[model samples]
Target: MPRNNDLNIILGDLKSLFSIAAVLMSAMVVSSLLFWELRSAAGFIAGMLVSLIIAAAIHSITPRSEALELKHAIIIAALAYLLIPAVSAIPYMISTGMSPVDAYFESISGWTSSGFTMLPAPDSIGHSMQLWRSVTQWIGAVGVILLMVTVLIRPGTSAYILYQSEARKERIRPSIRSTVRTIWKVYLALTIISFFILLLAGMPAWDALNVSMTAIGGGFTLYSDSIGHYDSLPIEIVLLPVMIAGAIPFAVLFMMFKLKLHTMIYDIQVRTFAGLIATGCLLLVAQNYFYFYNDLFSATRYSVFQLVSAITSTGLQTTDISGWSPTALLIMSIAMIIGGCAGSTSGGIKVAREIFLVNQIKLWLKKTLLSKKAVIVIRLGQHKVVEKTITEELNEATLISFLWILNILVSIMLLANILGPEVSLSNLIFEVCSAQGNCGLTTGIINPAISPLAKLIFIADMWMGRLEIVPVILLLRTVFRGFGR
Candidate 1:
């Protein structure tokens, strides 16, 4: 591709993203208008204008090119993801009269699919504003996948390579664009189905709409207490399947839809994801039996819900896990960190990576017992994984897991230092893990009462976690280089 053409392609992507942002802003404005929130409508308009100006300026100044280097693609992806949240926060600030930091924090949390809330309560916020929050998550979840497919996918090869960097390597279709469209279609269909299901379960129209959006997006509901407010076991049961559906890999869903039963059954990632959920649920149930609830059925219900919530990164809770035993809390935290399978709406390191790492370890142990003349190869499913690929995947998984541990440790110490020694260190770590994994389950630590600095730290962790850290790091590197120049 010609240099000029490559730049043009990059510019085109920027323009396209800006156009999408403008559309989202318009949705917010229209929704606000319906709810008679003129202030929010105006803010939406202002945000759109700002985004357009920035996008146009970048497009005009940047050279047009047909192709871009992988580095440029990574830089652009990171910057665009960061910029959108910052711009989206304008309406929140204007509508809710929140401080700039709080607005940005909320916006980042929504876009990153982290369910943490700094708002006083959902009831206090305007209907339009609440809708905007849910809408932002719905859009963000789809937008993240779309951006990965469109801008990051190089020509001639499927974008699976770029997808892997985002911890989503599965392909639902032959082409990146097709895969994106398919996922969007499935996601939209599920959202609609979930909306009606909630309505049928007797939730009001507004609640149904908001919950559906959050459920399908693998996001937390707007209510401060989440599903606890419903006080309806039927509603909770209805939401259970929807959250699980949201966490399922889109590629596997597509295969199932296409009647590829064997493919669905044989998928390594899907089986592993299911197994992890089962294992986590069993442990939590056992804890409930020994401590919280003596009734088996009641204990099982809450345990399964909590496990699903953490594994899916949806953050909806039926009961408080803070009061649970230490072993239970630790198990749930681990579930949060592992999260759902890759190529799903859920976030975190992902079960696929975990499975891969475990299989790699087993292979390593076997290799130590092999004879010198033996030729052995590590395999996943039907594919023969090269030693290099195995090593690379293992290294990436280890690095990410290590960082998660380090971040949790740092956050605990910071929170303890600020909140005093009375705070439980384990609970603090759980909160940090919840925010970083976008799991949203808290041990009652995150709230309006928390200090501003701690809130900001959690917000930053959410953003870094959502982007899987690399893009944000690259953006910082770019800034430092520019300053040096």
Candidate 2:
């Protein structure tokens, strides 16, 4: 007795859900093969069958539409992104026997590319599960935007709206699909290049593969100590550049690929991103020289690695940053929050927004210095930004930044109430920054033995951070509206 339109909506939702399940099943199959775990293989098969059944049911029940509305697209994207991670966590729970919350935390962390893990050590988890973790980040890095552009978006305003909502406003090509394919090509090429470099740097094949995936901010390390497990300067050097590359905007990479060196070098956002990295590195190096490690080379190595890792949101660490001075830790925390450029795998507020906000502030100062009637326009790169655009950008950036602070403060209080006040506020802030930035580096607070509630909080933070909060909010709104009913 349901209307045909209502049935179609339900069917579309089911299809999207099944699609996510299929992705999880595929990952599971890969994990099963890697570990040669029969039980996991069975799980993968069962998952696939279930997904196919749902797909079949949806296909049978509903008719296809020529185009989808913006609301429909947002709903589909939100559900797909969230459900993929949730379903993917099942295998981790089964393999590691981690409590449901811990497993969800790990899965969300991986999918969000946050890299923070509750696992005790590298050897503690099976090879297959670790690989699965890496895969989740790698997939999530490209994101639902890439998928929509490739498979859904066509010419016109709908595509534009979807692109903006996806937080990838920068277009690399005339066609959205072409842009996505180019981005994917660059991403995969970098992955391959990183893999070979790591192998040459003396990592074993499996280790190289895992580290290569993680080096680009995919946030899955094969070992517990992360890049530190290799203990090789060569490996660190190899990874450092790759992490930087990951942080660079994909549109810039496409320009570089087209041999437009000026576009790559002269880009305002890229230049600012590079400048921030250099500044952060210098500060950390100075801190290390004065307090941590007096050795010049050791200090520079750790400083560069941590800076690049945080800036890129890669979260792979060569040293325990918890032992660093409070000043150094604070600097790194801020770097993590700033993150990389737009149109990249890295997360956080992003360098582009930071540049925009700074420029807006400068314009305001200029106006204040001039007569009250004077007009001022913000400038970024070669373009003069409109007042409306600047205002919106500032408002969005401020809201997100304030929300992040609030979340961090609440999390710290929760942790303090549970873990005691002995834990330094600085360390708590560092962990919060790491998780929210999707940097994956930790202050040793996230452990297998932590309280379940704490783990859930971190997981929620990672999920919110990765999606940049909007999609999750929309998903919640949809649930409250009872569309599923």
Candidate 3:
């Protein structure tokens, strides 16, 4: 009876998810229609129909039992990541003429905010498709679950579970629903302001809007060369703060609404992130100036923008990553692994995790010097962290970091086996790390020509990275348990 009830709740949650997806698809259909892409519009509308039908069927069959729990939320969140992309791929398959695998890969990339593209010439894909890509990333940036929480789900345990399951660790309000709504509003305001700034920076209106969406999500590009297409310092300067904002905790930004500038400045995660970026920028500038480019000005120009992009996990490249020196690549790779803050659109192990790991390491060494009889408590940020809390966090961070490194090795091996001797080891690592970190920077390896197996591996990496691995792990355990039973 318990198993049956859990199944019913899962189905009901999925029905709600699909219902929201239908609305999203309807908007896409309208956008396509506005662009006179009748076939593409029809494809999107068809997907909406399919979503609605499935949602309706689930609603009609499933009993109206609110047997919701954290497990149900975890399952629903995992399934949403899996299934939403499947439905989203329909337009790509029908209108873009991509294979099912490639279409699914593109959808997953956009939905995960990973920004890896299978399409070689994104500009050729038409305006609606471009807008669709941006829209997908924008929705994904905040997460589909968070969207449901703000606009659909009521303020309750279910909303809270869904929020945490999506790896959202920050709340700006007491109520989960109110918190999500506030964040969404902040997200919208930032995106709009960025759009106009880009426009004033001389970008076309459509491109501005699209880039604003992608940049705010820390997601993909419309052009093949990414932000490099503009080649305007003013444009990159305008985008810099937007990308930084996307990488920051929404709660910090919310505090700014109340004019808590001191909190924003003194926040540990923000301070650490800013310091890392500054130090990395200096290192890369010197390295590039001495070894890669003779002109210090030219080196600083490229180094600062790329470092900001990488550290933010925005992945909007202005310079060619393939040509960067090994030292520069290493610096950028470390930044990608550390990523942005705890509750940001950017992905990685995250700055918060790294902060915990570093502080814990310091505490360990201090204990080695202290007497056994002494009592010591470590402080993180402004709060006193107990030994047990530090130990648990250290364990969690170590496990997640291990998984990240393990997957990087696995991906490198897979790419070597599949793509052969032509692909350099460093380039493969860069590509793999970019995928797993949900950073879109690439070494010119990602494209349609890659094997379906490689694309699938990247898709899995993006999914795991975005959820920070726990929900996905729990989901797998749930599946295995069901099978065992």
TM-score of each candidate structure, all chains considered together:
0.91, 0.90, 0.96
Residue lDDT tens for model 2, 310-407: 88999998888778888888988999889998889898889887886787788788877988876667778778887778888888887777777777
Provide the global lDDT of candidate 3 against the true structure.
0.85
* Index of the highest-TM-score prediction: 3
**RMSD (Cα, Å) of candidate 1?**
3.4
- Angstrom error at residue 240, model 1: 1.5
lDDT of 1 by residue, 412-445 (tens): 7777888777678778878888988887888898
The models' CA-based lDDT, in order, is: 0.77, 0.77, 0.85
TM-score of 1: 0.91
Which window of ten consecutive residues has the lowest lDDT sum in model 2?
Answer: 1-10
For candidate 3, the TM-score is 0.96
Q: Please count the clashing residue pairs in each candidate, in the order shown.
A: 11, 1, 0
Candidate 1 accuracy as lDDT = 0.77
True-vs-predicted CA distance for residue 247, candidate 3, Å: 0.8
